[model samples]
Target chain A: MKGLLIKDFRLMKSQINFFIILTAVTVVLAVFSDNPSFVPGYLPFVMSVFALSTISYDEFNNSSAFLFTLPVSRTGYALEKYCLSLILGAGSWLFALAVTTVSGMIKGTAVFSETAAAALIILPFLFISVAVMLPVQLKFGGEKGRIILMIIFGAVFLIFVTALKTGEAIGNDIQAISNPLSGVNLKALFAGAFIAGAASLLISMKISCSVMNKKEF
Target chain B: MIKTENLQKRYGNFNLNCSFEVKKGCITGLVGQNGAGKTTVFKALLGLIYPDGGKAEIFGKNITDFTPEDKEKIGAALSDSGFSEYLTVKDIIPILKALYKSFDEKFFIRQGEKLGLPLNKKIKEFSTGMKAKLKILVAVSHKASLLILDEPTAGLDVVARDELLEILREYMEEDENRAILISSHISGDLESLCDDIYMIHNGKIVLHEDTDVILSDYAIIKVTEEQFKSLDKQYILRVKKEPFGYVCLTDQKAFYAENYPEAVIENGSADKVITMIIRGQEA
Candidate 1:
């Protein structure tokens, strides 16, 4: 598993410059706009997508076949991908948080509250994105997998737009929706989201393992 | 050290059923043309693909049941598969070190340098010969008990091929328990290196024989039509008609030489043997 991780890290190194430039640009935009939430909100998604790039690299030149020849199991390989995703996602999230907090401190702005809120919302989405995309990538590989992902996300976007339009047509009674959640415990809501995210990841890992096991080459 | 019994796999029109063994302390060669099912056999043994029937075993354990520890004993260099092109030789060393308990980092690096593999260059940047050499170096560096090399000498020049074979020979000399199951289109390499050789045709093992027996005993006799008609046919395994005469493949070289003193006899080379076996008519 360590070997697999090391190989992925090296493969990902080529994109390091791009990531650094993107991070700097995001941080600069956040500082200038006085919207520190933007950094934490977007960084996790970028990192999660980069994590998937490693999979593409593995599939390139049929390297995955050779990879299995090493002392690694199909289950272990699936688990390692999940672990690497989480590590990269969490690392990017924390880096964004630190940058936002420090820049806010220097500028004398109250950024922690906004950053924390954004983290809570985006972190779960990051986990879910990785959880969902992994099995698709493992099953279809890079080219076809990307096409499937695009179609799925396109459908999701259409559905979200439709829901928003319906809410507007219904006269946008925001208070009525908030009323039912007014007494809900924030801690419990966050815990539930975390549990759901963890469950999604575990299920994804199982599916990836099965896909890998059945995969030829 | 490795064995396959009635191993089978089928795709639409092609069916692969091959069985062969590589004993401890010996180098076994699989010789075949493209699409002859040599890769299928290798993949089955490595558990890269599930066999539809029969079993493949390494060190007496079924391939499907191999744990990480069990797999650690194997080092393979597959022709159509390899490390990501983005990785450099330096980047791969640590990964190999962590994966194989007995991986020798120093030796790997030294061998890489010796083979002219640039340490910092990505694998994609290397030429085909360099890539081939690198793969062999990686496979041999870990001191594996079994080495499965497919077309390891494909792109190498004669000098490089000889050097690589020497390295393999030295590796085997280090441990009598070690074994190698290799395949190459270069019959000369197999003829010199393998203790035993298996020839596959279409999707079946057509021939398997000891290298010594093949080189020492096998012969091809060129005889006139009259001579061929009068010659005893019991010793002939395969026969091919040519414009000049009849070409006969026989293992009883001495019998033909003594009985038909006027017949032209040539020692069987691997290439000649394969051609005759694959294309000749059964005697």
Candidate 2:
């Protein structure tokens, strides 16, 4: 598993740099807008793109067949990908927070309290998206999986837009984004997301193992 | 040693049903056209893909039973994939050393120096032949009981191919029980390196025999079309009719030569046998 992680990190070096640069740019813009909440919501979606690049690496380089031949188990490989994606997304979030804090200090006003709110709210959604996208990437390769990803996001966007336009009271049922940490129940949300992420990870592992195991070369 | 019993797999458009045993201390060559299940066989043996039916066993244990400990004894290089292009030979060596208990870093370094593989250069920057050599170096450097290679010399020059083969031959001196299985469409390499040959067509193995047995027992007979029509069908495995003559492949070459002294009998190798079988299928 360690070997697999090392390999993935090397493969993802370019994307890692891109991710850092992207966060820097996003932070600058969010600071200028004086809306810190925007970073967390927007960062997950952008980081998802970078996460997609990792899967693309395996497909483009034809490394799937080779990596399986090593001593690493299929289960191990799947776990590594899931863990890496989570870590990468989390790392990007932290960096954005740091940048946002620095920018907040630069400006006189105490702004971006919403940004912390957004991170807490958006983190679970990111987990769900990753958990969903992983099996698709494993089942279908990069190109087809990317198309599926776009379709899924587009559908989600349409639903979100429709809900807003209808003036739905869905927001009332959901926890308020005020006070970032104090307004919401952190324990329950964390537990739920952890369980959801774990379940989704297991599903992804099973799918990847079975699909890869049955592949003929 | 490796064995497969009625192993089968279907990849939608392609299917494979291959069964063969490779003994220790001998090089076995798998010869097949593209998409004839050579790579599939390699994958199945390494447990990369599960068979739809049947079983694959290495060293008498089922492939699925392999733990990381068992995997250390085997090394392989598939043609379509190898080490990641992002890793340099230097980085790869250390990773492999850490992964495999029996990884011989001294041998790896020696081979790298000997082969002129750039230690700091990423694989993406290397030529196809160089990449092939790098894979061979990694696979061969390990102190393994078996080496599985799929088209390892596809893009190699003549000298490079010979050098690789020579290194493989030297590996034989390290351990008398060591074995190698190499699959290639190139007939010349198999003719030189393998002690036995297996030919695959479509999804089935068309022929498997010792190299000497194939060389001596199989013969290509040239006959007029009329003669071909009159010839005994029992002795002929396949007959290819050209404009002027019929090229007939026979298993009972000695018997046919004794019976038809007037017909021209030419010696045949494993490659000719596979080609003739493919031609017969086309006809």
True contacts kept of each: 0.90, 0.54
Docking class of 2: acceptable
For each candidate in turn, the TM-score is 0.97, 0.82
Can you write out model 1's per-residue Cα lDDT over B94-162, one digit (the tens) per residue?
Answer: 999889999998899888878899999999999888888888888998889999998898878888888
Real contacts retained, model 1 = 0.90
Worst 10 residues of 1 chain B by lDDT: B184-193
Task: Report, to 2 decimal places, the DockQ of model 1.
Answer: 0.91
Clashing pairs in 1: none
Model 2 spans > 4 angstroms off: A15-20, A23-48, A98-122, A168-217, B11-15, B216-218, B221-265, B277-283
Question: Model 2: how many Å of interface RMSD?
Answer: 1.9
TM-score for candidate 1, residues paired by index = 0.97
How high is the TM-score of chain A in each model? 0.93, 0.76
**Superposition error at A163 for model 2 (Å):** 2.5
Clashing pairs in 2: A36-A115, A37-A114, A37-A115, A213-B50
lDDT score of residue B156 within candidate 2: 86
